[model samples]
Target: MAATSSLFSLSFAPSRRRSIPLSRSANPSSAPSDLSSKPQLIELEFLGPKAGGDGSSPVDRVTAISGEKLLRNIMLENKIELYAAYGKVMNCGGRGSCGTCIVEIIDGKELLNERTNTELRYLKKKPESWRLACQTIVGNKENSGKVVVQRMPQWKK
Candidate 1:
């Protein structure tokens, strides 16, 4: 008991600590500006039930701030419901684990980054159009165009 007490009483600290320097950001906000001369916009078409299981429209189009990341812009930061199942913790949290965040790339494939290994593995069983919303970045090298996307196609409601 005395040895245990002594161990608890001992002060443990790092021998030397290194202070990391912080880099200055061009923008005050957390979001960085796209390289395009004009602000890039991600155009999303939220596909609803075509046969009308719910009152939602067959397709709902929305234009939002030009965020380069798809999951961060749409799922995390915005109210746009890209999937029937949504999660930050329960799902992969944009790491491309859970396939719940899959969306169909109707157009603007060039606008996105590339298919992550996670998406490529998970989507092997699915169609080529299917992509994990979290893995898909909105803008690409040439950011002058709009990134068009269609929400999950299997969404009945």
Candidate 2:
């Protein structure tokens, strides 16, 4: 039984190694073509309030695949600061209920999905530019463009 098991293992080992090289060779050739045909990347620029509280802040640029994620998720993934000190402690964790994840859309509004019902109720009196990041979807996955977002509005800070 031992001898038979060892023979079986040895026979399969060489075949497994041979298959690995064939799969690796095939994948590299196909990967580039697939990437080229995929949709263009969406660029996001997050602007934090100026330290002086008087002018534009420096831009933190990030990119994502269109329509793949929410604004809050993208900001968190990139380590961009999206909440005020109070909001950090009280945010609803992307459920669109707490309204702590609000941001201003400075540009590329068309790339995002329309305001959700939660946003409409929460921001009824707020500017049209103000959006709840947790409710904002970045793109339609088909459109690609630059979106500028102002993180943590000054009033909140």
Candidate 3:
């Protein structure tokens, strides 16, 4: 007798059967028509060589980090010293309104969260690419959204 192929795969849970629209963004925060004028959804990939010590800093090598991971790492790496403050201060760990984790995306502008009044206040007057990291977390699904991050402007250095 020949083995039969089941119509449904029982290996994965039924609840996990959710599908993501490839050409469109399921996240309202990352929508394209957002007031910010920045592309709200895209897949960002690591562009260049690995980041390491050859007297090279994080910015020296081209490393791609998801919007969420980037925010967490920045807060952790800087010991929470970098971000600015928001109303009453925040402790919920980046639910996207504190405006503390504002950052600029140097490349791959498509992947990001919508801009808000809080974020606008924090980002200094500059060219495009500015965004709030805490608000821009990307999912881990294949070819999920992403945004490229770079160090703060040179003057802030």
TM-score, cand. 3 vs. native: 0.38
Q: What ranges in model 3 sit over 4 Å off?
A: 1-56, 59-70, 73-92, 95-98, 124-126, 139-146, 154-157
lDDT per residue, candidate 1, 1-157, as tens digits? 9987776655332212324433434445633543334555767666543545555556656665454556445654656666564443366556667777877777777767778898989899888877888787776534645555566666644
Worst 10 residues of 2 by lDDT: 49-58
In candidate 3, how many Å is residue 51 off?
13
lDDT of each: 0.63, 0.89, 0.47
- TM-score-superior candidate, 1 or 2: 2
Ranking by lDDT: 2, 1, 3
Model 1: ten consecutive residues of lowest lDDT: 11-20
Better of 1 and 3 by lDDT: 1
Model 1 accuracy (lDDT, Cα): 0.63
Q: Which digits, one per residue and each the tens of the lDDT, describe model 2 over residues 1-157?
A: 9999999999999999887755433688787776677776789999876544555477899999999899999999999998888999999999988999989999999999999999999999999999999999999988999999988775634
The residue pairs found clashing in candidate 3 are none
Model 1: colliding residue pairs = none
